[model samples]
Target: MILNQSVIVDIKDIIDKAKDKAIRLVDHQRTIMYWHIGKRIFEEEQEGKDRADYGNYLTKFIAEQLEPEYGSGFSKRQVELIRQFYRTFPIANTVYSQLSWSQYKLLIRLDNQDKRDFYVAETIKNNWTVRQLERQIHSNLWERLLMSNERESVLAIARNEKHMSDAKEIIKDPIYLEFLGLHREASYYEKDMEQAIITHLHDFLLELGNGFAFIARQKRLHIEGDEFFIDLVFYNRLLRCFVIVEIKTTKLTHQDIGQLQMYVNYYDRYEKKDFENPTIGILLCAEKNNAVVKISLPENNKTIIASEYKLYLPTEQQLIAEMKKEIEKHDYEMELPTS
Candidate 1:
């Protein structure tokens, strides 16, 4: 009674298709179920306008009743989450399938409507997983936008565009490298950190922001029999240029700036296409002497940059203090009389 070989193959294909369709159907159904639950909770809470204390007790009681009947999916905490979800996104049509409940929770916590909209748009545009969304949230992507000259422009692009145009557009200055899990005070060599970044390249790229693809590590360049090795090389499709990153474990110096400048020059002359933009060089260090950086680079310098990297996320107060210092410096410089 066994089927022939061709019949078996056909049957297997049909089964596979059926299973795929079933899984998709199940996902759709689950999404609908959650939306409905959220809606019901919202309506009930509105109806019991005077019963402020009753809401909590009612959710717990409902959870107790539903858990046994509907399995563990209806836990009290989850019910509360569902209620919050409804309150957050009243418009069911805006509930994207790509986002999970956890991501929604984070979005709801964002007080600024513009900031929340930017994250939601980016989340959908990038097809970011919940974990990626969480990482970006933790990295203070919204706050970083506030530092940009074109804050509104960037938000508009993020909201309306399908993909970013360049890595530079998305990359934050002084990128937070806290995910590296290195100690701030401990002595570490530049090569050691470079190696670590290469080893954990995926996570590093994620933290580097969007549109970056690793080209090589310790990419060798030959010029008239002299050999030079670039620490790390990447191509940013959005920027349409090669990005050269040099790591320094200590404070930045004029020498670091000069070295990066040379790398940018080399890439532009030998590596970059005629239509491509000039190669961009980044000098990443533990600390930077801003005066030294400004003096070392040409007044019209656009290809090279020096930025600090942190081994740990700064505390809220620390971030605020740093921001305040930057603002004060700007104000003081502005108020000073010109020579």
Candidate 2:
């Protein structure tokens, strides 16, 4: 018998969906089994709670008995982690079915409850792969965001507890582009960096944050017979605005900020719809002077932002230094006398 092309396509789709469902079912069952094992271990430890090492003893004992029969996954370290997983999420129903064992393993390692919660919400909302979640953690995404926002506010947005009111909620400063394969010692042109971003557009978008869609590259604009080209243009659905990114391979100058301000102004006046929010302009540069940037923009300016781009993720020490520098700057600004 012969089948129509549409029928064959539909059949293939059904088979694919069935396979996905079966995999998910198996994963869910495995997660439940681990939770049950953890629960039993916790209950057994309760009897000897008075002893300081009883919990460790119980887990090690359980692992020794189970590993030989069930394989390496039930080893001592694995058993201890599973028990900690149960401690982290006591209620079995709170365990996210959408996440896999590998993803949970990463989440369970986070010491901060708020940080862990933020990643869990982001993973579920974004459908992030285990590798993606791992990258975000290693990159210090939570700490980077915390630099600009309050802890509760950041957590609220991640948890979908509040609507995002500002672009900073999603825009990150000192964005990492190690995936671009650019060496710190190597000199690259603006076009070269722009091309690299285009080549790894998927990773770029993930780094850009949620709700951003690429609109154009080398977006041309004509004003009174003069022509200008924007290095990149993107639209953010959540912000309901156009995002213009100007690439600078060196330290930013006031002139660069002025040029970006013009692009933002032009887009706001000509391209943006009546119902849309004001266009936002970002200067993605290798370095920027905070004083120069502040003086370049108007006091009330919220549409233009200067964000530094790093070729690699900052180490823990470097991030701490940056945080301290930001805190000192904020304190200095707060001390300035009002007019």
Candidate 3:
């Protein structure tokens, strides 16, 4: 009699689970190892009582002794990093296993304690990987916080006690669109730019920072018997609000602001749930007349933002020049005696 054969073991599932468990175990061990290394280095440096020279010599000696045995991972730079890691985070208990060594390296480089703490909390809260953390840091998330709100207010939000209350709280001015790979001086139609953004949606969202999820592209709406299509729509889970993005290939006009405002109003009144906050409208234009934008909006306007989009990232010199011009303008205005 011929017996029918069937497989009893699910090898693929078993292997997958084993791989996941192994990864977790490795990460846990690495975390504990780093913490111990940091602690030991810190103690040795302290005992020497000459921190600067001691730190330098310690790293060199450790590198020389460990490199031959352990491989390139024990280089002088890495030893220095371990020393810094200890110095930056003195409490070993606070070391997070979920955070990779690369993430810690980034955090320890930040000189400001509050900024480091904010990043750490946000990374943990959002479950951000090292790449996401790196991107957020490169995008100047700390500078954005400073520009978005008062120091105390931002600190409160950073501490997770409060949510961003307005569009200005979350929107970055001069939204970087360099990933679209368009030339700054080259003229392009609005539709062309919109299509590029659609094609590179993932990169665009990464540049847009965290908590944003794309809702629709070219979303249609009807009002007063006229149909209008929004360029892009996003929902920010953290802020609990709809974000309407409008693209302009030319300099911004008052009409553009008005159009975006209409979109924001529509989303706030119709699309948003009762529990959700007011919708935010962002006008991403090639250029903006800040004076016109200031005058076009209401005195208490907080829902609409007119931000210039740059096809290329600004050079250091360009940013410095712009900052100097702003300072000069402010100083000039201050010097002009009040009527």
RMSD of each predicted structure: 4.3, 1.7, 4.1
| lDDT for 163 (candidate 1) | 48
Cα displacement (Å) at residue 274, model 1: 1.8
- Please provide, for model 1 over 251-284, each residue's C-alpha lDDT reduced to its tens digit, 9 standing for 90 to 100: 8889889888988999988889988878888888
TM-scores for all candidates: the values are 0.84, 0.95, 0.85
lDDT of 3 by residue, 1-339 (tens): 864443325666788899977886787677668778978988887899755587789889999999999988789998888878888988877688767777898999997988898888878777777887887776666655565456666666766878766666657777877778898778788889989999999878766756799999899998989999999999998878888999998899999998899889899888999999888888898889989998999989888888888776666577667657756876797899987
Q: What lDDT score belongs to each candidate, Candidate 1 first?
A: 0.80, 0.91, 0.81
**What ranges in model 1 sit over 4 Å off?**
1-28, 160-168, 329-339
lDDT of 2 by residue, 272-332 (tens): 9999999999999999998899998889878888999999988889999999988998899
Q: After superposition, how far is residue 94 of candidate 2 from its true place, in Å?
A: 1.8
List the candidate numbers ranked by lDDT, top first.
2, 3, 1
